[model samples]
Target: MAIAAKHNLELKQYDVTNAFVHASLDREVYMRMPKGYQKPGTILRIKKALYGLRISPLLWQKDLTATLTQLGFQIVPHEPCCMIKDGIIIFYYVDDIILAYGKDQSKKAQEAMDQLKQRYSITGGDDLQWFLGIEVIRDRSKQLIHLSQVAYYEKINRLVDDQTIRHDTPMATSELMPREGLATPSEINRYQRKIGSLLYAAVNTRPDIAFATSRLARFLANPSQEHQQAADRVLLYLSDTKWLTLRLGGGTAMQVASDASFADNTLDRKSSQGY
Candidate 1:
């Protein structure tokens, strides 16, 4: 959406400080005393949403949707996560929201955002930087929008001290055959941990790792030595291509093409080379 604007639109972001807390609870519930509260005989009477509760997210979303609707924003039928007003489009993922609109609607949206922020525990204005771990980079000149997770890679590298690892293609052309032996309990645990981290990286911003991550994740409990090596290859790939990012140019729409060969899975044994 930003790409299609071509610098004529401005992008703004805002965060709901305690989004769940803003949600009105419909059920009567009680909570233990908060740490600082001196209510020795009192408990928190449920009035608003709180994390870990089953109904928290739903309540927050309901309230948030209502608030946005009241502000003259029309919820897009095709996308409940999106709202539109005049030329402005707003997309929300829980508490984090992105507003995109031309110059005229920008100020009005900003005003509404300011009013909302004041009424609720929300953060707004131009200084908002990161949202949901996704780093936002705006090309004001070309009006291009790019989201990446290079910071996340750095964090993982620092944690594992794998910054110097080499990068390789995520997948191998070779096929695998399952073995009859069971995996050691400790080995299985370790494999699951490593694969979990890799999966997080792949889903966040590293599309290049998607294939490799998915392929290796299937053998988490009883992975062969070959699978372990393939997992390492993914780390190496990240190390070498640490700067690679998904770049979005000025385009009116997104077009994706995919080709799949039936029986692509090795279990089915049909020769397939697809992207």
Candidate 2:
């Protein structure tokens, strides 16, 4: 997304229908026929890869990598899932592919996509809007791109009851100490679920909650009411700032800042650092 915004490029998404079924099998495999499709006392030999098999993903990846490489797309050394040739970049994740290219190279990108469409049942040729639950909004005129998870946040919010209170910060200023007693089974399960959801949001677009989420995660083994309240505070904060998004491509220069504290962790008494 940042690359698209930086180059003022158009982003296109494509989905390969029945992607796993397309890859040819390289080994002998057999499966029992369905109750209705069974021949009398006979099993079926597997031809194409099936979805449930463990090796299916490997077969698909090998096939895709071979095909893309044959078409002159080079696999990025640092990011194996990314394929690039000229100015056209293709980011492949399983069956989903995102194409990014500048206006001048749009034809080349389309041609590559067309070649893939010829081989597989491709379903998309529209502007990139949503992928992996992240909403992408681009503004070419202003040279900015925003990534948000409002829908995901709302979905998580629905998991819990409505809250009249909202928080400005994800966590309180005071540090949290480990509770004295172990949480009940149900309490532990619920706390872990909430932490998992919040962690996803943090890793995706809500970096503001990253520290709080991480801290809460430490108590997942035996969460307490106070810890649960901290988790709720994070959710309340999300409810209030659901519209917050990560913006990219405002400037060319890269900037970095660092800070550290000695023995900040109350439990471990270790220095904490961040950038």
Candidate 3:
């Protein structure tokens, strides 16, 4: 997504129909006949990959790699899911594909799409608005692109009790200590679920809550009441800032900063560092 913004590229999305079934199986496999197809005692041999098969993804990936390579796109060394040809880039997550190209390469992009359509059954050619649950907002005039998870945040907010108060920050500066008693089984389960949801957001676009979430994760095995409250605070924070997005582009140069604190962890006497 950052690359698309940096290059001022037009983004498009495509979905390959029955993508897994397109890959032919390399090994001979058989399955029992269905109830409706029962005839004597004969079984059916699988000719193509199926959804339940563990090796289906590998087969699909291999097929996609071969097809892209034949189309003059080379798989990126560091990112196997990415393919590049000239200045245009193609990124695929399972069956969904996102295409990015500069203004001058619109024809090339269209041609690539055409080639893909001829090679496989696909439905696309529209400007990208959403992908993998992330809402993509592009402002070509401002040369900016923003990624948000408003719906995802709201969905998880429903899981939280209505009494949770909103907060400006995901966590407090005050130190958190283990409570005197262990949490009940139900309480522990609920805390784990909430933490898991928050962790997903942190790893995706909510870097602001990453540190707090990571710190709270330490007590997952036996979270205390205080820990549960801290976790709830993170959800309340998400509700308060559901519209917050990660913006790319609109900057001339990159800037980075780092910090460190000696012996910041009270329990382990370990130093903390961040960039």
Off by over 4 Å in 1: 1-8, 34-44, 158-167, 184-186, 253-256, 270-275
Report the C-alpha lDDT of model 1 over 56-161, residue by residue, as the tens digit: 9999888877887887888888888888877667788988888776676757877777766766787665633576787767676876656677777666553332
lDDT of 2: 0.87
* lDDT computed for candidate 3: 0.88
Greater lDDT among 1 and 2 belongs to 2
Question: Which candidate should be chosen as best, given lDDT against the real structure?
Answer: 3
TM-score of each: 0.82, 0.91, 0.91
TM-score of 3: 0.91
lDDT of 1 at 125: 52
Per-residue lDDT for 88-162 in model 3, tens only? 899999999999999899999889889988888999879999998989999888788998999999888865754
C-alpha lDDT of residue 190 in model 2 = 89
**Worst ten-residue run, lDDT, model 1?**
158-167
Query: Better model by TM-score, 1 or 3?
Result: 3
Candidate 3 segments whose C-alpha is farther than 4 A from its true place: 178-185
Per-residue lDDT value at 34 in model 3: 82
TM-score winner between 1 and 2, please give it: 2
Per-residue CA lDDT of model 2 for 41-143, tens digit only, reads: 8998999999999999999988888888888999989988898999889997899889999889978888998898888888988999998889999888988
Question: Between 2 and 3, whose lDDT is larger?
Answer: 3
Task: Please give the lDDT score at residue 33 for candidate 1.
Answer: 83
